[model samples]
Target: MFIVSLIFFVLFLPSVSVSYANTLFLHIEGKNDTLSIYAETGTQTKSYQVKRLQDIEALYPLLQRRQIDRNSFEQLLRELGIEVFEPIHTFIESSSEIGFVMAENLVKLPLDLLYVKEIPLFLQKPITYSFTKINSQNLQFSNTLSALIISDKTADPENGTYFLKKLLPSSAEYYDIKDINLTQLESIQTKDVILISAHGRIRFDNNDCIGLGDEQISPSHLARLSPKLVYLDSC
Candidate 1:
């Protein structure tokens, strides 16, 4: 299975956005346009090379317009790799906490949830989003998840946002929506991990936007935030 395997790299996809999670990725250096993905454990590696890059890139706008679904993401996740994701491109670290990354610039899209083998059930429906954190020094794995969590009052109560609190109860520093802002995030320096539980949806103009109480974070805004372990519980 993709999960149990050590290193599963989705080198490229044809018409979809490709990604997998929870592994240590140093850097990606491939030879041709047709990339061979591999999963690595110790010295061995595995590849999930499906082959779509442009088609996946086109979906971002659709996602922003609130026209995409998990099925679309699930299908896309298995098909393409990107080249530019301004946010979270700094470097990813190793941790037990699960996270997702963009392929190619998959770096630029909404890298929310990650699963092995197949997309998760909850993610099989409509829209829901998530992100990951990183380590620049090494790909060392850890089982701890201590992060700065901003839980929006309007975050989904029955799904992801609700469950994470129960899962990491004491591992995170919880802050109400009213207490957080763009400045704090721009100057963020303390915690290495950040998980935001908020309402993320597309506005009339079709640009991606997340409503975090007084601040509605756009992708451009998301791009400006300092790089770190990030998670977005967008429902």
Candidate 2:
């Protein structure tokens, strides 16, 4: 019986490990033209996609030169009203042809949805993206009335917390929590800004992103918590 139990445990161990390894906790927020992607690895979380597409696309050629094949390059040019080259087959054969096409036909045109909205998804850290405005001014930081910075023990010990701290006002308080427990939230000073920078997923359901931390909090719950201001920096 002991020998049989050992064999069964050995067979299942790899399966258990694979199951945990494949898990990717992601958060998606926004409606219509706006959307955000938040990803969590264990206790650490990062947020992206709240900026203008043109700015984000500028970083793409530097990061993903290899991924831009000839076909992709031509598609980009046609969208820009540049005359299509006749020798399509020759371009596909050359490894560096896409770079030349991009330089000639599409270089001057502003970044469209293909470059700005899509390419940033492939770049390395710290993942950069923009946020939606509570008010009308999207370009400036005026809409950012309040912010919160949450630090978990397992998160990046350096720049993660530092960036949030720098972005938030000196008046905003910082919190160190192991997880998002609602009981802990009660202690947060009322009418103060609330920012939860933690490892969790925000799901888009029925137009609003549902906040699921240690406890599941709806967008409405967040609105009620601080009527004046609320921002979730969760991943």
Give me the candidate number with maximum TM-score: 1
Give the Cα-based TM-score of candidate 2 against the true structure: 0.34
lDDT of 2 by residue, 92-179 (tens): 2222112111222222222222322224111211111212111111113433445444565443345365565566656455666545
Model 1 has an lDDT value of 0.43
**Residue ranges of candidate 1 with Cα displaced over 4 Å:** 1-51, 65-104, 109-146, 159-172, 183-189, 201-209, 217-228
TM-score of each: 0.43, 0.34
User: lDDT (0-100) at residue 161 of candidate 1?
Assistant: 47
Per-residue CA lDDT of model 1 for 75-157, tens digit only, reads: 65544323222112222213223233334434433333332235431243222112222322232223355556677665645
Q: Hey, what RMSD does candidate 1 come out at?
A: 11.6
Which window of 10 residues has the lowest lDDT sum in candidate 2? 1-10
